[model samples]
Target: MTSISQTTRPAYSAASPRSDGLSTGFYKLLFMTPTILVLALVVAGPLLYSFWLSLHEYIITYGMGDLVWFENYAVMMSDEFAGVSWVTMKLTVIVVVLEFLIAFGLALLLNQSWLKFREIYLLVLMLPILMTPVAVALMFRLMFNPNLGIINWLLSLVGIPQQGWFGDPDLALATVVFVDIWNETSLMLIMLYAGLKSLPQDPVEAARIDGASAFQILWHVTLPMLKPVILVTLLIRMITALKSYDLIYMLTQGGPGKVTETISFYAYRLGFRFLDIGQAAAVSFILLAAVVVLTVVLLRIMREN
Candidate 1:
């Protein structure tokens, strides 16, 4: 019986990896060739072309001019660039801070074991996120109009004076930040709440058994454990805030003497509105570099913690 079983078993081959006419590694490379080609054509091609364009003085009316090396990058030293950079940084900081606070508060509240109607509350909070950013901006624009806006009427009923929201230089950025907070806080809330839910209960339970207060446990134990998730969430929101353009376009259009203009809007103005494609491309690359640097910094902090 043993001899018959040995005869039935197939013999081992040293070249089994290439028995099908192609080695395993070669087959993987062959299969992946199409994806590599597609990525090169669709992604790398345009990226390299844009970098090339940034090296020249390209105006739509004058066509592509002689290569000027980093001359287009000199825009970074201009006063307008300084102003827009300040605005972008200000907006990014304000929105990120406010949104994080609001979201963290709501996440803590919703994470309570005794909370009722949690799903309904989550659904209501998530409604704003369901709306497109463009639609949100347009709706807010109509609602906050100085003249025929319902927001002004509502404020008048409460004895507050009607104020220009998107049109006022002082209030335009603030109004945009409010709209952003309303639209984005839900996303942060969900992220934080998920992190909270995923945390192991042992530390929390042990803290409680050791007579630790709720706030102490949260500050010392829960928050330390949740740091990675918090960092990732903040990084994502910060990057998107840095790239803010659609909301600015729909609501303020960087109006009231460019008080609301961000780097992204500045780039758009340079390229399409002002016809300086080279400078626009240069600005875009600068923004890309800033994002990369910010990502690296955040990732290092995450790793350290």
Candidate 2:
């Protein structure tokens, strides 16, 4: 019997099996296939198509005309479109900053200890966001009609001179910016209020117990913690503001000497009015690049913080 067991077989190393590794990888790919397909169809497909179109002088009516290479981009970088881009950039910055400040203040007010009828306040805030953007623009158009609008009527009651709201070249952009802020600040407020409510209360209470003033607690403790939420909100609002078109179109139609012509509105005019599809595509790509850069920078800053 001892002699028979002399030739023992080598032990099997189950941990080092290639088949197991391959099977694990296969399962992961299988699980991720649906997500990959969806992204390819919804995002990657359109993005690739747009990029391909950007490379060629493609017109909607005439079809593909010429392989213009970077001509479209070069044209967009020229003096004519540069002004539109600059105006858009200015509006984006102003609207985002003002909206964030106003929304944050509203959030703080709503979150106050003695605030009453929270639901009613929130509902009133939500009304603007809930209204159709086109309808909101039309409503503002009527209100800002320099001649016989309600805004001018109210100004008359106070014995102030009625001035052009959307008629004057200098005033049109500001009027639209004000309307945009009014319409969207509620969404930002809601987001911030939720963030405030969900925040851990113990730290705030601890700060208060240490005789920290409300401002000190907010500045030193609460705000630092709320930074992530605020950054996210800012990024979202910035993107929305950058793409603002419907309201601008409905209110001013890029009028008052094109003072309120945002990049989006400009792109629309190029594509629809002028039928310059290639130029419109180039403008869109530029806007896309700006948004991507801004999103990446904000994300990096948030991560660093």
Candidate 3:
């Protein structure tokens, strides 16, 4: 009877903790594999191909030619390259600074609890964001037309002389800047407004209790807390402004003596118009490098703050 009881006893084996952890980790990786493969295929593939094209003296009509190494990159030393770089930097700085100021002011106004019809104001402000960039550019082009545009007509009503907004070399860049501000300020406003909404109320309440003026509180308390968001917003906007192409294409086409030409437009003009793919790719890579360096610096600043 004792031997039979021992033989029929149930097994009591338990999985080790290490084995459980390994299995859990394996499952997690199994689920993530598809996403990793997709990113490599979509993002990494095109980047590598572009870099490869930049190293060669390839023309679209003549097919891929000799591998010319860094000769294409030598275009950076050219006067035309310098001109476009200056235009790009100027546009980016102007648009970013103006937009941030406008957006921050609007965000503050909209965040006020006593503001009436706040939703209506928000909807009106967001109207530009809903419109496609192409549509905005085209509309602005029509409105700013020297003779037939409403803008010139309205100025005439106010006893002001007609201005060559886009046709005049002196005014073309400023006109482009205006259009950019009109279109892009809304996005900046939304970002800042969202940041304001998410800010903790405790610090602000404490400041009120201490009898701090509104401007004082904004400068001393709010700005420091909002620095990270502001930096991130500026970084995103700067990168975008650096890559601006569609507006120039639709409105100016880099005309008026290249006054509004940006690095992106320059690259497009080379690759498409001039058919110098290698040089164009080099220009694009240089812009990419600038954006990457700017991003790294801004990220570091954020971490430090």
Candidate 4:
């Protein structure tokens, strides 16, 4: 009778502890709780707070003013903000395109097996990327100075007129654009180089055997294979370029008549310097929205391509 009763019992209930699943689930929640809390505290909370602040006219001296919903956003969409937005976009595009072109060329050159001491060359080239943005910007600032600059000195050696790089409003933004290209090209090069090295040789060999020209092979085979890497590289560079502040601040401080004033620096000026916290927060959220929109557009294009 006892044996019969034991055989009739459910297998899972007889074998396993009831608390096993519950305990495992509890432990998982416990481990993940800290991360959840930190993310809420740092990211979500602040974003919400900024939005709340943006809806009100909160100045530093006077506390939170009347809830003037969307007034700040309205002001931000004016012609003044539009000009800054255009400048920011222009800088991003110019810097990203130049970096891509230069980096792509360098990547191809480095990928060649005939190059001697290639590792040393790569290491030397990578030195710029190792430095902090502020430090790099400061270094370039000295080099771009018209009077004491090595750049002007070199120009003078070649009998060319010494150009005012950062001092001239026309050249100031473009100079820093070039500065960004120089500083960030190495990252693109490394990423593309790794992608090139990792590509399967079969398709390339087959293309060659089929008598495809070098350009044809690169255009059809290598580039198609490298699409993912290229997309990733473009995405990263665009985001970095969009939020460019440290280098700009260090080099020109958005001087020479506010021609180089990007939206990030403009926002900082609006809030911290001018003490219009509400409007500054509004500008920030607008910038954030713009970034998100651009990123989404980029992602969509990449996916479609």
Candidate 5:
């Protein structure tokens, strides 16, 4: 009886092994192939191509030539490029900080129960974000025109002197930064508002019952609890600010003596204007490195929190 049972069990298992094995293998491949293909196309392919370009001295007219190794990277690390990098960093920091402050305030205001027409206000705030960046830039450029612009006209009524919005070298960067903050603050507001809405209400109610002022509750309880959301908003804003180019380009074209040129604009000039593909590729990689470092630091902070 034992021998017969063993023989029967072995036959049953053997009959199914090959078919089940084949089916499992097929299912695994079906699920994995698309992911593998997407990674190859989106990540690996461009990375390899950029690395190859970085190794060579590539010019639009002359095409790819003898490999130059690190020459392009060396040039990018020179004083001029270093200055551009500094300016980009400054712009990124200023925009992110200002945007966060404004967005947080707006979110708090919008979340208040006494506010009227909240939906309309939110829709208006989101309109700038939805509008084409180029169009928005142009609109701001028109409004801020030193002469024959409504902004200057209003300033005249208040007896304030007209200042260049995009024309002045010193003011161009600041103006563009303001535009960026205005355009993106609504996004941060939306994110923070969502975070506020999802927050557990029991703590807030307890704080109120304990005679906590609104400011005290916000400072001690709400903001602390919203740290993750704030960090996420900051991360998004920083990355976006770092890559800001379209609005600046449309508004000032990095003009008034390159005062508004961010790393993205610098890369564009290298690749398109100067036709230095290798140097452009190097600059792009450098920008990517900065972004990667920031992202890693942000993620680490989030994990710790």
Candidate 6:
């Protein structure tokens, strides 16, 4: 005789939740629609408008002229964008590399279990990030003032000549880069510290058992394992550097004969100062393309490694 259990139908029948294929898909689609619409409205809409504006000689004064398709871009091709580009590259590379090195070393130090007063130290380190960016820039601007500034006073006491930090073309870019480094280093430290904390102790222990020195383990095992985190951190820093504007703006205003002018600053000047919105849009698109290409190249490198 068959048992009762054998005769019982399965509880997960054809009419159960698993069989609601179309309904499940429909619900997923419905949930995703709002996000899609928002992106289309906020991001895509402006981007397309910018492109369209770039094709014309539109300006507030002119109130939108004839559609001079690609002429704005062509005009830019003949003009000198080299200086801004060079300054941008210089700032981006220096800030990212220095921040990574300094943050990585500090993160390693902080990860030591024997470190005392860790919380206090971390709080102090995080102060820069906590402060507003504009405030930080303005404070630094005062500190870097050539005359009547504390920095100049200290330099005079040390027998160093007082130099215009942001006023001198040669020194302006480097000074701005240093200020940015100070402003954003805390972010690097926080992210790297978190990455260090989340890393598994197993491989590190194994390396230690194999008689690996601290630096050896760090260089070989720890860094290799932290590859993913490192790539992400690098990408973020690079993007931020590429798009840098406000702090530089406050500190220099692309001043001292445009020595500190970056691509973003150039775009701002074209749009607002020169009132050439069409040309500004072209520069903006070029900057966006450059960022996208760099991001793609970086991702390719990460995947290859």
Best lDDT among the predictions, by candidate number: 1
- State each model's C-alpha RMSD to the native: 5.7, 8.2, 8.3, 6.6, 6.7, 5.7
List model 3 lDDT by residue over 1-305, tens digit each. Answer: 97777667533122324534555456668899999899899988888898999999988899889999999999999999999999999999999999999999999999997999999999999889878889999999899998899999999999999999988999999999999999999999999999998999899999999999999999998898998889888988998899878889998888789898899999999999989898889999999999999889887977887
Better of 3 and 6 by lDDT: 3
In the range 21-104, model 6's lDDT, one tens digit per residue, is: 645456667899999999999999999999999999988797899999999887455435777888788889999999999889
The alpha-carbon deviation from the true structure for residue 100 of candidate 4, after best TM-score superposition, in angstroms, is 0.6
Stretches > 4 Å off in candidate 6: 1-22, 297-305
Model 2 score (lDDT):
0.85
lDDT score, candidate 4, position 234: 86
| TM-scores of all predicted structures | 0.91, 0.84, 0.89, 0.89, 0.87, 0.87
**TM-score pick, better of 3 and 6:** 3
Q: Give a tens-digit lDDT track for model 5, residues 1-305.
A: 98989877753452345544655456668899999999999999999899899889999899999898988899675876887888898888888888889888988888887899999998888777787888888888889989978998998899999998899888888888888887877788889989988888889899999999999999999999999988988997788788778887898777788777778888889999999999999998889998898899788877887
lDDT digits (tens) for residues 1-305 of candidate 2: 75556445222333333644554456668899999999999999988887777778877889877888778888675776888888898888998899889999988888887889988998898788888899988888888787878999898999988889888888888998899988888888888999888899899999999999999999999898898889888888888888878988898888888788889999889888888787888888998998898889788877886
Judging by TM-score against the true structure, name the best candidate: 1
Better of 2 and 4 by TM-score: 4
Superior by lDDT: candidate 2 or candidate 6 = 6
Deviation from native of the Cα of residue 57 in model 1, angstroms: 0.7
Query: lDDT scores for all predictions?
Result: 0.91, 0.85, 0.90, 0.87, 0.86, 0.87
lDDT of 1 by residue, 227-299 (tens): 9999989998999899878999998888889999999999999999999999999999999899988889887
Clashes of each: 0, 0, 0, 0, 0, 0
> Superposing every Cα of model 6 onto the true structure, what RMSD results?
5.7
Preferred candidate (lDDT higher): 3 or 5: 3
lDDT of 5: 0.86
